[model samples]
Target: MVRTADEASVFPDVVVASIQMAPKVGSKAANLKRSIELIEEAAGHGAVIAVLPELANTGYVFSSRREAFELAEAVPDGESASAWIDVARRCKIHVVAGIAERVEDRLYNAAIVAGPKGYIGTYRKLHLWGDEHLFFESGDLGLPVFHTEIGRLGAVICYDGWFPEVYRLLAMRGADIVCMPTNWVPMPGQAGEHMAMANTLAMANAHSNGLNIICADRIGTERGQPFIGQSLIVGAQGWPIAGPASKDREEILYASINLKETRRARHLNAFNDVLRDRRDDIYDPMLGTGWPLPRH
Candidate 1:
């Protein structure tokens, strides 16, 4: 439901769903169909926001740049994006999902955000991983926060979560929640018992920023590249409210978040606030120039 500003103030709690699924390589139609079905299921279960995995429609592990280009489409105007917008409009919920975005001859690993009101925005993956470098350009648009009745929303993709700056920038802009669509591969030396690095990063960032984060991951092997699935929803306090679902399962994890509470939690005590405590005076103003020395 597209709540009015007054209604949002009256109702601060919003249920979010993280959909974990396996998208077959090159099977765009089937993947989108499955995504729609899962989104409908989330709506039926009372989710106001639904997040899907990176490359949810086209799948990961493309064979070549040519293959990736073939799967890519224009944002908000492409077939995949249009279908998702339609589903969001029909279900009366917000949808954040990953797609291969084409802008002329260039392609990007991107996420499209849509709502009951229609298209919202897109977030291109800033950090590329492994073979992705061969198929997509690094995102040029810096982190952007989108305003909604529920609260301010932001998004990042896969490897972007590894950098604290991504979450910090979003929180600095007053974001209450972030949608992460990822295809997590087993990290180097990852054992069966160790907690997935992706989940750990989500929890730590959410706690540090006092922001809710929904991480939706894909499962299964595509062209011999296996993806780990442990999709989860983290509360502002950095605790898992729903799941680190099974390593290889198609499921949706749900959690209810109160934007007011999330914003309120940033105050660690009377003397400190997470964002307020940052010593921006000493930190480098120009990002990507490497760390600067603190001024005397």
Candidate 2:
């Protein structure tokens, strides 16, 4: 974990708050109201950047595509996004939230970054989990980074964290910090083990890319699905700076990230200098092998 004194002395200070929001099952209006309350709370705590969990405006569990579609809304025009924008403008803070987006007839699990300046950008989930494939369409766009009052920020939805490539791509694209908003469910068997996965991903990605990684996960039960709220902030040195909270009531986690340390780490360690070490020419087989001898 990066110390506060070290962080204050090194880089421009930015306070990030991760909100563990509890969405009302299938109620967009109620969820939006609750999100606004959380945003105000974060702003009151002096947070420059605030992040909410994936599918925060509506519960993640759905019986069918119709349910997901019913909750989906347009980018800036959506009720959720508009409410978030209003809160951001009033609080003078930058906000990142995940929502079910409606593009024509198809639904996409999307994350939108809204601020006092209005909607900044949007990122749809690239990887869908299991039954999600049957409803939401996978995002095709690559990882993106945006310049804000707090500095360069990268946004990634839930399942996107499972892949290291997204982190590398964002880091290579000049993302100083990556913000992940997730609604991860704790299955029948795995209760507290999900934190390990989140920690490993945050540490490895931060260590390898020399960038800060902040995550916000949902809490409480929704439609019988229990979420493990392990919202946390990891430093550029691949260590937890703030949390690894367990599944419980809604909570807000705060941490300060040093941008200078990120640059220093990258300069000292050549992990981000992938061009000098990678051999792409010989790795074509990893994509697919043409080996075929027998046909049924």
Predicted structure with the largest lDDT when compared to the true one? 1
> Model 2, 39: alpha-carbon shift in Å?
0.9
The sequence of per-residue lDDT tens digits that candidate 1 reaches over residues 1-296 is 46589857775688999999999989999999999999999999999999999999999989989999999999999999999999999999999999999999999999999999999999999999988999999998889889986678999999999999888778877788999999999998787878899999999999999989999999999999898998989999899999999898899998999876777678889999877777777887642233332121
lDDT of each residue in 247-294, candidate 2, tens digit only: 777888898876766656665444644322345457554322332311
lDDT of 2 at 47: 90
Error in Å for residue 125 of model 1:
0.6
Q: Mark the regions of model 1 whose C-alpha exceeds 4 Å error after superposition.
A: 1-11, 286-296
The RMSD (Cα, Å) of candidate 1 is 4.9
